[model samples]
Target: MEFIALDILPFSVVDDVCFRRLVEHRYTLPSRSYFSDVSLPELHSIVETYIHELLAMGVTAISFTTDIWTSDVSPISMRSLTAQWVNEDFVLRKAVLHAQECAGSHTAAAISMAFEKMFETRKNPKNKVHAVLRDNAHNTTKALEECGVASLPCMAHTSGNR
Candidate 1:
């Protein structure tokens, strides 16, 4: 039940007979409120621990990708940050660093601050962030410059308003 909701699935999934049969009566799903109060926070903690473990794996260089967007149904804009790295085994690894509300005005400074906050906990000495890949918007490019890191334009940023 908790993992369903965390994965952005419907909470009522556990109510399905097929799902219950799949679990085979070995576990009872917790209520929505119980999941909210206990399971969600615990799961977040677990993920945080996992992220730390991943970052500590001596990756040499990391990159970031980010975007901000708003919905027609809501008056708020949100930003998502993703981290990319090549591991010791030479496999590319990616992780979602954050999905957070873009507070204050949508200025270059504000977005720069958002980048700073996103990287607050990812200061592994073994890894160096090479660049941030983002859209080629005026504000976004300016924000990247303000963050003082090398910035690369995303190849798919063809939409003018993005």
Candidate 2:
């Protein structure tokens, strides 16, 4: 429920807790006292393991998008949209890579390169890239075009602004 509130609602973590408190006085927040801190190397190893497992399962091809943000200390942050080809029918599955550094055009180019690497790792060199759906960012569009990937403007954005 905490994750759901964080992902789908505009409320902050504290706001979510407060909301739950308002609904039920007897309920208590989950305890964070028993968690183990994972080392950076361990985290990387786990991610690599998952990637290899995905590749072994015949996942290939991908599409990407990026969002840029500024932190309180003026550092740039990025959120990434990544997708993989699933099954023989070509339905795409996606995951988010959050709070990465915003590198502008380079970030967009990196996403394309990541897809290329995923294709190579899956041994599917003939993978078809259908489209990159993103907000109308010039650098991102340029990068996608340069990578020989077609792009489509985000329809949700166009609709929201209409």
Best by lDDT: 1
Q: Report residue 67 deviation for candidate 1 (angstroms).
A: 0.2
Off by over 4 Å in 1: 1-7, 15-28, 122-127, 158-162
Candidate 2 per-residue lDDT, tens place, 55-145, comes to 4465555554544455798656564545455654565555543335555544657656654554455443434455667776666677667
lDDT of 1: 0.77
lDDT scores of the candidates, listed in order: 0.77, 0.54
Q: lDDT by residue for model 1 over 9-121, one digit each (tens)?
A: 67666677887788857687767676667777888888878977887788668888888987899988999978888888998889887887886788898888877766775
TM-score of each model, in listed order: 0.82, 0.51
Clash number for every model? 0, 0
Best by TM-score: 1
Instruction: Determine which window of 10 residues in candidate 2 has minimal summed lDDT.
Output: 31-40
